[model samples]
Target: MTGRHILVVDDEPDIRSLVQEILQDEGYSVATAEGGEAARKARRVRRPDLILLDIWMEDVDGITLLREWSENGGLPCPVVMISGHGTVETAVEATRLGAYDFIEKPISLAKLLLTVERAFESERLQRENVDLREHAQPIIEPQGKSPVMAQLREQAQKLAQHNSWVLISGEAGAGKGTFSRYIHDQSTRREGPFVEIAVGSMSAENSAAELFGAEDGETVNYGRLEQANGGTLCIGDIADMDLQTQARLLSVFQTHSFTRLGGSEDVEVDLRVIATTQRNLEDEVAAGRFRDDLFYHLNVVPLHIPPLRDHADDVHELLDYYIDNMVTHERLSYRHFTVAAQNRLRNYGWPGNIRELKNLVQRLLILGSGEEIEVAEVEQAISTQSVSGEPTAQIVPYDLPLREAREKFEHDYLLHQLMEVGGSVGKLAKRVGMERTHLYRKLRALGIDHKKGIE
Candidate 1:
């Protein structure tokens, strides 16, 4: 009911209109199709959460269209078969073809509503199960008993109860997505869709169309923002959003609306935005790469997820959790970690944080033998990872443009030298053979804080 789209397909205009009106009145966004072809075209335009298809269509019977859809890709969503003269054989065939349920044409309004609700609930459970089987986190919240983690979980929960936009900052792979999901689940909008858009992964040219959608002539494409209406829109790596798209997004925030590509009508939006970033957006804003207004708007409720190293005490718990998850979900042979192995891991530096720890556990489960994982295996894994990491860290990334590569090298070189000189600008200038004024300018240009990173 929370902005879920439903498509009603019936040859009779009255039936189609009647069904659409009822569903819309029930708080669903409804679309109507008069025949099988119209239904197919409607589905192609936008995916409906549930499909109400009449079996006794004029052009192609509902069963044939359903089977065509089933064979082509799959039944796109949960479908309920509608018919007045449906036999037991017809009902059996529809069910075998992936229909959620069957309803007679003189539909009982109450029964139809109940069936639709049940279908949605069933679909949600199916998705959660699929996610669990895929070895994802499986709805478990932040798993740590450390003081910082305890406080973080509590703070996030409290913040999630509000209506303000959230800005979550953290290191890469530090469970930013997990925290975003946590907030949405804790929020009043939990029943709504939680659409995630990874801005960093999107290309510049398609960013706008992908996010704001597109409209041309009679066709309309619903974008992520529209899909997430009456819900939460979680944007990952918001700092990497294209500048043009940034302007559009800022305009949306200011007006609570946006126009799709090639369309003049403004689409009013009613949803919370939860943005996540791994970079210092303040620095990005200062450098004029990000819009300051957007930053301030999203930063209303800032939550920084602590890197795993700060809570190393939770390593033991994390290790056990992953072990059980792998065993339960993936059916991997479980191996218990010896006390020595656990202790070694607790003291080890997790450069990649929770992500690294999870991968390490997965590797040990698949590759190591014996019921108990010994410290030797753990040490070997750590050593191998370190050796690999060191070389990768030392390699100058050739993929970057020459200017970027040079700037990165210069930044690292100057930062190391500054740290080496005990954060003393005078000593750093002397060591790097640069004038004090120019050295200070260089540090500022590279976004390096000359005052920090020293004992």
Candidate 2:
């Protein structure tokens, strides 16, 4: 509230003047309006951070104006109702009408300032939702129209509507997590929790504990299975689960029930399991490294997400999506990619997939030191850091939008960063000023590997 501007709307000049003097002395910028019409005018003119609206007015009452604003949704600022005759019932009615808070007449200056501060804080939190939406909107796009992709999405949607177990197989960076989320979003239990466990990242014993609550008289923390009781659970790289853990998991799946590691009580749940693997589970089964029964159970609704190379037609669409996102997130004056750059993007073997492309777009938006991403920039970013000593792909013009071309440049640039940093997400996130969770989400969305780079 230090620098916030406050609007005091009152028919009485004396009350408005008192509020203005008090708030101004407390370091808030205060503006006064004589009546409802004047208040509305001031709101539009000043765009005050908070409003104190008097209930009784000549032309219109505060409650009426509040109702109008609530119904039409124009004024962005929060409104606090004020009235000398305001009763608890009137205040409750005002609140039900969408007034942020009600301050009765003969208000204490201390209480007034405190309420105003809270109103400003609430408004700020509401604005953050817009930011989250901007970040989440891209990954929320339906799987595109490629025949293979459409089939994948169709299967996911159909399976999501049921409570069947699903298994997703793909090469690294093939958007397994994205598909998993899509299934969860489409499922009958969409409102239920969708817990994900990274079997490869966590220790086998600890991972078991995480998946099936703790043992031994210890208060059982809810495991992924318990958390996803009515919904879905995604197991990333399930092929990496140890034999013992796999055996226990298989039991849970078989009985549709599990007990805490140390507890004997059986907890039955209705869980829809979704497992993902970069490695071929069939090969793992042949090698005896994975449980064949477990694999079979998870494979009930088997889905193979095709790699980026298989969906070359979607390259431009993906590029545009990433670029649009990058330009907005980085607050950059977006520039188009040169013709040569577009050619290079379309031809490049995107081993990292969509996640890789997303990171690249973000990198170029924030790091590319050029008006437009040129072929030379792509070459310098990719070829100079050749992990396999291979020359960069020759530019191939499959005809893409300037924005799409820029996205290609970005993907190349992102790969370059991963190469430079040896694929450390923490370091990458730090460099980009984003949380590791957010960076990981973007990488997963773009189909980029957090482990391997261009190599």
Candidate 3:
């Protein structure tokens, strides 16, 4: 699906028609504007992947248009200037205003095609190499007030004072990447580039060249290490790195320098590294899957991320946070979770951790309707691909943590009272000597349905 839309803005009807027709033939979705005002209107309607703007337009020149856009919200996409009588001074000014490239008119069709292709490719690569935090809202406070999480944040802040490398470990989707960014953002070098590379996604043949730049004759490709110079480089899924790459990385850690894959000169960098793993690195080292040297080096300041279930109390806050996130970023309609629905979710095992919870919120927003999400809706949602493939709430184990054990006893005590009173919550509450509202909340927290097995 080459859904790439290009906006062509020029006053001349003939040139616009010719360019539009040619670009359309090349499988691009092309939109044309007669002049500056039309270009503005077209851009308001939809953001373009690339804009071909003429230097001399009837209403406004391309330079003024670029200036306006830069001031407003920065250029929405790359803009390439086209001028038949373009002077070097004009080209320099256009470049200064953030024009991707200059295309002199008597436009070389071959050059035009190549520039368009290269612009898209460059943009794609830039997005991939930049910070990997998608849907990046302010991290706000750590939503978890659980002591374990608070101490973890404190430890992160302490370790951030130094430029020492860090290794973050957790289950998949347990927010290892989140803590890495928190550490980076808190560190002294926050203003510098914070580049990230997904090591697991790279191939064995390309991994070394990707981590360390490769030079081919006159052409040189700067890799993640060079890109992250003077700042933090988060090597995501570091345990997935191949042995050869691990050795090369160890060399870089030993000496803050590496030669480009095909070049002779050594490039030195002032770098801080943050590596994340969802697996036990020591086990990997013993299995000969990962290098012992690399393991020790990364474990210098290791931070362990607790699973979502450990601090289950935070689930309510996380639910609110994600709901806001979905509404603000994903444009999903807001839906309130009923007290009973929230309680059911908090007690869930959350095998997939925070990532799973976020997905669940997104799913409820998309698939479920109405203003409030009740407990039945939650049960229906979780029932599909549930842990046991059954519609059941998790049973609290006999040897549960003290907090959970107390909750379990309260739930059973109230449930038995409710049943004895013939499934009437009002009668059960009066018999239990508790306020109606507070007892209702307690019943919900325990996932006890007073209406169950009643005529």
Candidate 4:
């Protein structure tokens, strides 16, 4: 864990210096502002974890400044007010304006420290509560009693003890994000924020600003790196991150600091980075898509989460867990899976892993009325899903060369479409938006029996 940053805003140089020294001695990263204007500049430079504002100032009264901040950016951090001539009304007004606490000057050292500690604790709890309410299912470690899961969790726990960067490789829906959060929760910086950025979801135009933040005059937007200060930053689909952003991130990892977009000052950060990707990063590097240096840095503690097919026995435990969760949270009617149903699922391959299992449980609960889920229902559900083109149960070989993967997908898709069109080449070609002759030639090149599908 690292020290929290605190900003002290007061007109009295003596008081400001004294408080800064004291807070520094207490293991806080302190920034001092002589008055309100300076306070605004300090905040623009860096967001503080807490603030100590004096009521009286030469240019702007502390109360006015407090109200301004509350109205504009909603008080970015907790503020504790300091007043030389204190009154119940003044304290009441400050409290109403979102001040964490009020302290009368000639401040007692003991009271100041205690109040600061309480403010930090209160802020942490509030953030956690908000996070819980936002997420339907609060993040937790991957749940399973299977040997593979047990060993995965054990390895994660061991990795959590160190601050080295981690790279998690897994198939989609294999719970890479959940595993990252689990590591953060078990690590030394559990109290700090866990910021995750889905690199693939971000557009190239806004990627830089979103990852490194941007500074436009008085407005400052903190990026993922700044927001994740003193904690873990989990980057998802890191292989898809643009080359420019990758270079910038590489610099940050090397220097432990970064400059915001359009800003000159380098802002230092203390954070552990954990990157997750479904693609083979080594192939990405070899293909010149990902930086080799960055890949090496992140691959320090590599962990691969096996797909559901690898641990078929765990299907039973996962089914029960998701079923119970849906019943409790979604208020769906409870249903039990029969031994035959469970056995069938165990034998079936789960291409989407845990995510697929959860969805299956929820579907069975909503669509299935019986008190028990039988093998017949399971078979129907699986078969219907496959036939409906719900993505084949086979995991695509992401490590394959681009052209090979594309050809493979095209082959499977054309075959399915041909089967769906009932061996009619004209209908298949029309459905696939291709001329019948060209479609036939393509099928012949792909080694498909076009004669069977001819109109």
Name the lDDT value of residue 348 in candidate 4. 83
Best by TM-score: 4
Write candidate 3's Cα lDDT for 184-205 as tens digits: 7888876455778888889989
User: How far in Å is the alpha carbon of 199 misplaced in model 4?
Assistant: 1.3
- Candidate 4: worst-modelled 10 consecutive residues by lDDT: 384-393
Worst 10 residues of 2 by lDDT: 385-394
Off by over 4 Å in 3: 1-141, 385-455
* Local distance difference test values of all predictions, in order: 0.82, 0.73, 0.79, 0.84
TM-score each candidate: 0.72, 0.57, 0.59, 0.79
User: TM-score of model 3 relative to the true fold?
Assistant: 0.59
Residues 1-455 of candidate 2 have per-residue lDDT tens digits of: 12556789998888889999999988887889998778765644334557899999999888888876666534446888888887777788777877888787788888898998888777656644652443344366444678878877777778877877889998876788888888888877765556778898798659888888654421225567765665678899998899998998898788978767666667766778899999999999999999999988888779898878798777777777767765665355576678788778778777777666665555555556667898877766565323333224335356988877766665665555554343566657766677888777767656677665432
Off by over 4 Å in 2: 1-138, 215-218, 330-333, 384-455
Question: Of the candidates shown, which would achieve the greatest lDDT relative to the real structure?
Answer: 4
| Candidate 2 residue-wise lDDT at 121 | 76
lDDT of 4: 0.84
Query: Per-residue lDDT for 407-427 in model 1, tens only?
Result: 888887786566444356877
Candidate 2 accuracy as TM-score: 0.57
Per-residue lDDT value at 194 in model 3? 72
RMSD of each: 14.0, 18.0, 18.2, 12.0
